[model samples]
Target chain A: MAEEKIRVLIAKPGLDGHDRGAKVVARALRDAGMEVIYTGLRQTPEMIAEAALQEDVDVVGLSILSGAHMALLPKTVQLLREKGLDHVLVVAGGIIPDEDVPKLKEAGIAEVFGPGTSTQTIVEYIRNKVAEIRRSRKNA
Target chain B: MFDKEALEKIKERQEQWEETTLQQWLARLPERDELFRNLSDMPIARLYTPADIPDFDYLEELGFPGEYPFTRGIHATMYRGRLWTMRMFSGYGSAEETNERFKYLLKHGETGLSVAFDTPTLYGYDTDDPMAEGEFGKCGVAVSSLADMEILFDGIPLDKVTTSMTINAPAAILWAMYLVVAEKRGIPWTKIGGTIQNDILKEYIAQKEFVFPPKPSMRLIVDTFEFGAKYVPKWNTISISGYHIREAGATAVQELAFTLYDGFEYVKAGIERGLDVDEFAPRLSFFFNAHNDFFEEIAKFRAARRIWAREMRNRFGAKDPRSWWLRFHTQTAGCTLTAQQPENNIVRVAIQALAAVLGGTQSLHTNSMDEALALPSELAVRIALRTQQIIAHETGVVNTIDPLGGSYYVEYLTRKMEEAAYEYFRKIDAMGGMIAAIEKGFPQKEIADAAYRYQKEIDEKKRIIVGVNEYVSDEPITIPIHKIDPEGERRHRERLARVRRERDNERVRQCLERLRNAAQDERENLMPYILDCVRAYATLGEMMKVLREVFGEYREPIII
Candidate 1:
């Protein structure tokens, strides 16, 4: 039997309509052989969390370019945890400042990707992090 | 353009020169083994000669500027008489904040005003709405009602300087509020000139800011056309834009083709509305992107004018010469800016802005260098404004009109661009027009595929973006980021609340009722009703809610 695919959900969680980055990343992840589901434009944090739960995604990627990440990203992380998805590796991208990265990670985001990040870097990070999470969950 | 005997002699001499001189140089120093591709990924030839366009008809294809088939330019004088409008697309925080920014830009030699509304305003939401959480004044100014609109334009002369608002979806509502402002100031609607980016078709295709479905959206756009033609004659009703389409990762050819087709659809819709094409077509303007490729962008602009003029005169049967002019504004590509070496973007923007000038743009906006990191700070935006100033005053490019018009390479590239765009036109025409094509996700899918291909090229080293994929840098960004005063959002919410409370709720209710009823009827022009709603101080959200109930919202088909 083939190993289970790393299930991921790519979401755009704000009123920002700049989705060139989001769509490019989604296609890259799908091509990387992960099971990807895209939540179309203008998704709220609640909508994203609901999709995360229903889709049973192992990872959640949030993209925002409207400079609302300080308020939206943390709320998304809280919603995911409230839904008992603490194990889902939450990552964010799109115009987030470098100063906000530590704060976002402290708020339970696994990583924060800035502009010009390579898809291969993202693919490798997801593969390694998901394997580590699975091993920990199995041991637990 | 050449005599037959002369052409034969030149061709024979060129073959001999290539055989002997070119071959000798190539044997000693081989050419680089790499394909030279433009932003559109089209192959660029190493050399071009008259042989490339052997049947070139100078009068037929590129007539004198300000004449028929305006491939060279729209105006005879061009930049010699007046400079292109240096309009900066700006807005941030509250109305007060953006108003200050506008005054700043005007004082610093910005010729015109361009308003960039926040996400909420673009979506027709009030600042206090829950859906607007974390989004207040982030991307642009937050305008919830006429009170906000008043504050945004306070103390600005309405007659002297023209303004351009980058608002859609609720463009009619915002436009009504603007007209009311001018009316309060006792300025005639005909005297106040501006442009509302009322291109909703592009919203569905690339921008994703569309509210209502296509049919109702097209109806709303036609309503603006009818009203604008009658009242605000100087105002541009629709700015058919390719800027966002190119920014969303389309080739220069795709941007040119899709934008012209959208313009054609609007003409058809206006004619179907029983209005004469000449009455509304003249007011239709275009917006394009000046990307990294210099010659390709210049060729795209020239080809756009030729195709639009031919279509408006022949295909649409317009008698007026004004209707045939493809007047346009251009903005340097925002997607080309990088976060790694922020300062280098100034150089990139300078090159792009020069292309817009050479391409004969009516108005231009140069992106700030620090935009890839955040909204431009005061220092960064000044540098951006000065870039245009340098091009206009310092550089002697404005002294000549279409200086590159006769270059062998430029003419060949312009002809190729026209052919490629017509090819796309044939495909879109067969899909039963843009609306049917958009419903099938035709343009959206095309843009997505192009975007992915571009990214892959950069990732795999096939394309080189300095400071992104090549010439890597590890230095930390030290530029001062533009931070919105957090108090602005609170202040705006309070202002919105006061506007709602102080206004006569009874009158607001009645106006919205009439607007809702008018919106349900397809034949009714909703601009008059929307103007009434604005007069009663009905907030943007309140008015858009009625339309949302009447026409319903549009949900885009998932394409990625």
Candidate 2:
């Protein structure tokens, strides 16, 4: 049987036109032997979640630069839950303040990568998370 | 005098670590090649020296400020005579909402106004248009007609303050709308001062916000130059921009080289249109990105001025000194801001803004701290503006012109940057200029390759991003984020509907028909006809649709 490649969707939510980080992350993920899909700038949360569901990726990374995280992040998490995509790991990045990480975690975000975070750390985190999911599913 | 023994001791220690010379090392590592790195990579050498720029000529390469080959600055006083304009780029929701923001920015010590239009408005769409669904007032303010334009400006006097509009593709139509509004306010076109980011080359290169293909876009730009020279004498017809290019992941050198290449292309286009080079050249301005590398960013700006001056005077045969001067506006790199440590963005923006000031920007926009989170809250914007203010007043660097000009490091880097830029220009020329290169996927590929290399280095731990790799942060975020009103879109659509129901439909139809006719006719200037449509209260979508039918939409040739 052919090895099933890990697929990831990197998306930018809302009016934020800042996508350098997202593009870099996408490129890094692709290089790390994962199949990456990048949703270009100015995507809505609805659009992002829908893309995640349609693409059926192992991981979904939401890059938010417009500071609408509190309002937008909850909507995406809720959408994912409603879509029965709780198994798909959700990670948020961009200029998120230190104090909001707990709030985001509470909202079901798996991890938060701030500025200066290395691409390797993110890739490794996804790899570990995906393996954990696989182990849990096999036991079930 | 006694350092010889110390140097010998240091050399012995260095030899212990690595005994081979550079040449021997290169021989062993034949795969290692040095020249130009691809677009996305963090530059291999963070700091350059005299060895990097050996053939530096002060008189020929970097002449004094306000002189020929103006590498140091455009003006003698630069910021001393007048500090760079603190222009806040503001817009959101409807015309009325943006108008309020404009006034608020001006009241809060903003020197100039830079308008940001909603995607629909940018693409010349009316809020009520079906294609404009869900994007009416999310990104920027929507201005569909002269009525909207008038409401957008309201009590603001166009004659007194300069306004820069970040719009392209449908720039002529939007400019026409501004002119009609100015005319209504009894302000002659000559009295209005501002810049139009009418750079379509960059649209093809990085932004991907283009409407027409290259040839027609160039024609439209030339038409604006001709029209602006005749009427809006104080206005800058085109802002050759590298801000978008940098934001799209280009290095400082690529941003400098590509932006200047675009500017040169526009000049060439203008000459072909039979306009005297000096007549329109003085009005041409630039916009750049102030990224993380402080000294490198400064060197890029200095190199840009020198290269522009030499090319305009020597290559283009322009006689006017004003034509040689390269004035620019800068915005701190929004890409550099981190969402994890949102408060850190304030420090980052401060450093970037200072780099811009030292580099001699005519205008500047400091990104708000909460930018990476959402549209900047009012409080966040105020802090961003204050960043510029503190630099202007508290920082004494502005007291001296080009304070870092003669520094060994700055001078060397400036030359290196200029040389690297020329090398890129030569390559682009070989590929048949920017248009031909772009078509062949040259620039796109170059950028992508560089981006890939940079990412690889970060992954391998060759590059150390301060907060990212080495320093671990387990802390959560606590910054306040700005929230967009959910009702904003509904309110905008209702207002657009009301305007359509109330406006003179017949007049709108006639004006739009004229615009369409003008667009179809190659010889006719589209400005006057567009002005008429604006005066008729024709929605942006209506006018754009007509032109879109005439010009057809441009589809980018994806390279990567």
Candidate 3:
């Protein structure tokens, strides 16, 4: 039997006010045959996690151009975990410094894609990560 | 400069030359791509000459500087008379810390002040608010009430310094705080010279910092227009900004077309409110991006001035030449600054700043090199300021007036840009003005498409951003990201709490209630009421909350 399509919720968590990357990445993921839901700009971390839980998505991709990732992103991941969504695959993409990538990954993000990370790279990562999550769940 | 017969002869020769010389050159070189487009993705010609502009009437099309069309510049002498204001956007941490940064820039010969508010202030929330958790002093300074604004300009004289606040969603509230500051200094509103980045239209289009819905948000803008015309004559009530639009991944033509359309829509709204064109148009300034392409950027500025002047004079029927002027501030494109090899961005910034000066920007802000890593450090900010000073002092380009004005390439691109903008105008008009089109998600879709295409180009390596997509580096980033001490938020909360505790509670309540009533009335001008709120030391978040209750918050229509 064929597998079900992956669902991803993309959100802009905080007041960065730059949404070009968010919209582009959302479209790229949507075009890749994933069911993508994009919440518009100025979303709080709680809003993102609640949407993620409500939508029951396999992935939560955050796009922030503002340098508030250190504070805002962790809050988002923590909220998701608090809601018992630790099994969800999470990723971040924007103008994050290389140093911050480790910290974000440590904060439960699966991957951090900086500027110039190709859409295809992201699509494949999500597909692979979702497949891994489903396989692990089946084994458990 | 070319007559009809001369132009015709040149055209015939150009046709023959294209058929022969161009064909041979293309067969050998094959050109980069058949598209051959600019950053805005507008097609470019192989070669431009007199033949391209057949009826090129110099007097009518390209007028003298500070003249009717003002195609060359708004000032006759251009930079020779006075250099563009070397203003840098500065803010971080708490109000006191940002104030120190402000003083540092002023001490280093920065000509003007451009305030950058933190996300909470921008979104009209107080620092201590639950919604503002974990987001204090990250991007810019935190100003919750009049007390913070007071501390922000503690040593800086309100009358002497012209501060440009980069607050939009709550611009009226912030501007009122400035007005109250000036009033405290015993200065009349007429004496103050500054700008409120009160351009809500662009917020809906690009910035995404808008609060209320379109109709009420526009009413707030028109209120400022009416209020500024009467009291704050020297102030630029609205800086119709395209910097964010370009930064949002719009092409140069898209930026020009959309920004100008936003400006025109503001004019139409003002006129609909029974205000005369000449009364407020003179004070309507513009803000544009100085992107990487030097020539294209210059052409965009030149084309913008011409379009605005013609529209004001011919379409709006303004008798005052001042009404036709399109004075603008140019900021080096922040998106163009590469995170990899941050030092190389200095060169990029110098080139972009030169383009802005050459294009005759009235004011300029050069982005700091380390901005890609974080908000600029003190050392990085100094280097950025010196970059502008060196251009003004050492570079002799400013000595000449519009040095690139008459170049065949520049003129052709200027004409092409103007035509593209007009085409967009027609589309927008058919869409029943900017607001209607916005609701229908026209401009938003266009910006998204352009952004995607540009990013795709960069990813595919078709477009080369020096340090980003090419000449890659693996060096460790040593640049210091501006650290906001966690104590800043605690202190910010304490100060906001103190302001709430100390201020006259009854007066604040009365002022807020009045504002709420005025907001409900469609005909009421909100500026005065907002000023009353400010004078009573009401917080930005409080006022925004009242307006939200009355006007309702804006939820952007999904474009993708």
TM-score of every model? 0.99, 0.84, 0.96
* Over 4 Å off, model 1: none
Fnat, 2 decimals, each candidate: 0.74, 0.26, 0.49
The sequence of per-residue lDDT tens digits that candidate 2 reaches over residues B1-560 is 21555656655665554546644765777644464332323344533444444555678776778897887789987877999999998888777778888888899899999998877677666776654555666667877777678888899989998999999988988888888889987898889999899999998888766778898889889999999999999999999999988877788889999999999999999999899999999999999999988888998999999999989998899999999989999999987775656777899999999999989999999998876655778888999999999999998989988899877678877777888899999999998999998888677666666666666666676655555554647587566766556676677667778878998899989988888888888888788888888887887778888888988877666444
TM-score of 3: 0.96
Docking class of 2: incorrect
- The better-scoring model by lDDT among 2 and 3 is 3
CA lDDT for candidate 2? 0.82
Q: Write the per-residue lDDT of candidate 3 for residues B1-560, one digit (tens) a residue.
A: 77778887888998898899888988898866767777877677777898777667789878899897888999988888898888899898899999999999999999999999988899899987787766788789999998898899998977788889898889989999989988887889888899999988888889898888998888888999999999999999999999999998888998999999999988999999999999999999999999998899999999999999999988889889999999999999998887788898899999999999989999999999988777898889998999999999998988988888778889888998999999999999999999998899899899999988887888778888777778888887777766667788788889888889999999999999999999889989988899899989899999999998998888889776
Q: What tens digits encode model 3's per-residue C-alpha lDDT throughout A47-110?
A: 9999999999999999987777888898899999999998889899887877788899899888
Docking class of 3: medium
DockQ values, each candidate: 0.85, 0.22, 0.62
- Residue pairs with colliding backbones in model 3 are none
Report the Cα lDDT for residue A127, model 1: 94
**Among these predicted structures, which one has the highest DockQ?**
1
Tell me model 3's lDDT, rounded to 2 decimals.
Answer: 0.89
User: How do these models rank on TM-score, best leading?
Assistant: 1, 3, 2
lDDT per residue as tens, model 1, B1-560: 77788888889998998899998999999888567888777888778888888888999999999999988899999999999999999999999999999999999999999999999999998988899989999999999999999999999999989999999899999999999999989999999999999999999989989999988998999999999999999999999999999999999999999999999999999999999999999999999999999999999999999999999999999989899999999999999999999999999999999999999999999999999999999999999999999999999999989999989999999999999999999999999999998999999999999999999988998888999999998998888998888899889989988988999999999999999999888889999999999989999999999999999999999989
Q: Which stretches of candidate 3 lie over 4 Å from their true place?
A: B8-35
Task: Find the candidate with the highest TM-score and give its number.
Answer: 1
